[model samples]
Target: MLKVIFLAAFAVGTVLADGELIILNNPGSVHFEGSQATNQSFLKEVFTVVLGYTPKLTQPWDGVEIRDPFLLPEALVSIVIEGVESVKSPRGKHFPLNVDEVEEVTWQAVSRRLEERDTNNTLVRIRVGDGLDALGQSALGELKPNSVDPASLKHLSLNNEEDQKFIEELQLLRAIAQKIPSTVTANSKPDVYWFVVSGLRPVMDLHGKDSEATKEALKLLNDAVNDLSNAFTDIYNGQVVVALFTNDANKLRNTRSVESPRVRREEKAGELETFDAAAQNSSDNLNTIEKPITLRLSKRYSANYPVIFNIFLWFGIVFFFSLLAICIAIAGMDPGRDSIIYRMTSNRMKKDN
Candidate 1:
């Protein structure tokens, strides 16, 4: 039984050691409860900070028609015109447009002027149906074009009722990633999973009635993020680290709230230093105020010595049990040769025969 247990444990350890570490980059959508323009601006800033690129704005168009097969589809084309504008088509045709205009222009004409100052090059275009809110839909559409740098952008729908569960799962995957090693070799890089969540806190509080609800919501969000961190830690067996970035400092305040007084004082001092620097540099502007708080969830197992010692201890136990079992089996085999009763019985049986 002891041998079997040891073998099973050893097998499990081996499998975990050999298993490939999984890394995922899961970014949630930019959520905002504000004016359409405010929402768009906020989303642009988010993409700019997280992905390091700002996407150009395109006027909302109903439908587009593409004449050339080789050229980009008209649906994917975007035009930003301020007042009245004139566009020259590929067929040498001139078309005049008024302010806030939507035209079903040919792809050739659009592609020819794609590099122009006013025209915005979209990464991808999505057409929202009649029932959907166009502004909200367009905000989601803008995320992809802006997130072309670090990683591909995936805009998650905040309207899903099951978003809480999805967040929980993300947390679980992150926890798993934390247990695995970040780098397999000196040259090998660790897989990174990025979760970009936005608009968790409300932009305005009418009558200040929703304070408790807002706090609860923030708590839930923090819990989910923490859960993800813990899950990653367990999965990687303290290999992968979790880094959290948020514009709101309150979202991560709970993590420090439970720390010891001495630790909290240290953290507060660090935060004061950061604030002082920001103030001195005048970095707390409208665009930079919503800076992300990066929290690195490193491997909890700081050293390999303890883990190695534990492994050696288990191996010793298994070896000792195996040797004892072998000795016991060998001793049991020659019982009659060494036992007086057995020898007497054998002698009596021989005499009778």
Candidate 2:
């Protein structure tokens, strides 16, 4: 059954997509290549765990063709996961300060540095599960369970073994979908939404690929992905963009698949391929990146005193300071050899005094 999410629109226009950002995790070690992610035939085989199955009639398919051909599959994680933040050098000195005194590290604050197009925070953050923190887990070994102490890093390590992580994650996303505002027609803030879902288990499983224990543990991954994809669509009505990828390293590798990223600003639902698992390592280039219909840039020059209006103001200040300095020097001028005030107020120094 398709679960529907309902929201009343306040504005009177055709409600459509402002855009959406979905971040889902897949196995780092899998190689899901050469899978038909076309809407016509995606269910032929198991790619990764799974997510919502989308209809292809409205959404066409395009595979992202990575230009490289000599990259190793296992190294895709390092290449595909966005590394703009981690690769940056930290502030020269580090002193733990109060929360407000510290810099804003939220996704919205870092969105610019992350190269996000929208800096207005229109992409509402939809955090599904709270275990490993940060919706965008850029690196592996981030498989940690939710902690009670908040500050305590030590907890039941996910070690990427728990199926419950993915299960609870899907559940939370479904529940959260019903709560957020999906009406993007109004000219308001929070125009878009963002969801980050990570499935770090199956591939990171300690057991070997053929091990029954691993298979039993990862059986539900497919169901989770399928359901989440559908639920978001049912709620948003296909007015979203989903870009699924494995690692940022994949971009550097010889991997590529074309995806139907939203280009013309149309309304509809679609699914990009999920994070490629080893068994069905199916990583296709989902086109969450859509070019804007129109782009206008407004520039603001940072100058305290422009040569235009403020120049006089600064010039006046400098002129007064210079005049005052000269006056002070004149007032302090010496005896009979100079001004009347100096002659009256000052006396010749006694010899050797």
Candidate 3:
């Protein structure tokens, strides 16, 4: 009987490891009560503790920032922009000048880009301690990594009507991580995994108004996060990341007088399905207001001139003056510069030769 049970478990693990990567957001959106800078700092400090070193922001992007050495590389980032199909993965570390808002860069788009690059073109790289030393070189070459079927990702939420079983989210995440390749070898192309569970601490006083239950629930959540973090470190070997995406507000509502019903996990799952369907269907419709004509021009750069100042400013000015002078000189000619030219009657006329 024991042997049969062991085999069943092993079979489950085998199937998961061969499946697609799953990324799911924990139930609800919650943020600490604070400014944007404070939230960012708090997040950084948490990661510093986890990673054993502070991670430097790849770019200090405003509105939305995705910081990680392993996930999205610069070359393939263009696939996140407008006309994703036409944008080939180009060389160099050039960030897209214009990109859709982070929220707009849906998981569908990310999955699509990965599908196109799945032909042994995917590169896995890591940088330790935000330093120049790469944990693995991001060399683009033909490398037969494991094949991953594209899958959709979802952001789950738990409202007042939910059980708020955020801890279970971690358990689900563990199952997903188990699906990843157990080991990375020279010939084995493996991928890293992470979960961004947003909406932990709501600005609204969810448990206020002497509602002892919700308050206790909040306290329980704290214990869960710490316990899970320690477990992930030991079990996953610190390869998978658990990121709690949150923001804080200055003022929180005093809901001591309000009694909001908590939601159960089962109901939340159903809601998540509905939410996922709605988000996918309701993505901002992109209309091409101006028909774009693809124009090919030599990639040009200017030395010692800022792009906002227009590096070609001086060149254009010089060009204009030179052009005008030539045009004026020709027009000022007796007839025309390119007209039938007669020899000057006075090369030696002054000398009367």
Error of 1 at 186 (Å): 14
Ranking by TM-score: 2, 3, 1
Per-model C-alpha lDDT, please?
A: 0.29, 0.30, 0.28
TM-score of model number 3 = 0.28
> On residues 53-151, what C-alpha lDDT tens digit does candidate 1 reach at each position?
222322111111222212211111122211111111111112111111011111122222232222443322222111123224332222111111212
User: What TM-score would each prediction reach against the true structure?
Assistant: 0.22, 0.29, 0.28
RMSD of each: 26.8, 22.3, 20.9
Off by over 4 Å in 3: 1-106, 119-211, 235-240, 246-353
Task: Return the lDDT, model 1, position 225.
Answer: 49
**What TM-score does model 1 achieve against the real structure?**
0.22
On TM-score, who's better, 1 or 3? 3
For model 2, how many clashes?
40
Q: Is candidate 1 or candidate 2 better by TM-score?
A: 2
> Which is the leading candidate under TM-score?
2
True lDDT of residue 195, candidate 3: 31
- Model 2 lDDT per residue over 38-64, tens place: 210121111111111112212222222
Candidate 3 lDDT tens digits, 150-237:
2310222344433233333333323323423333222222222223332233212444423554444344433434453444344434
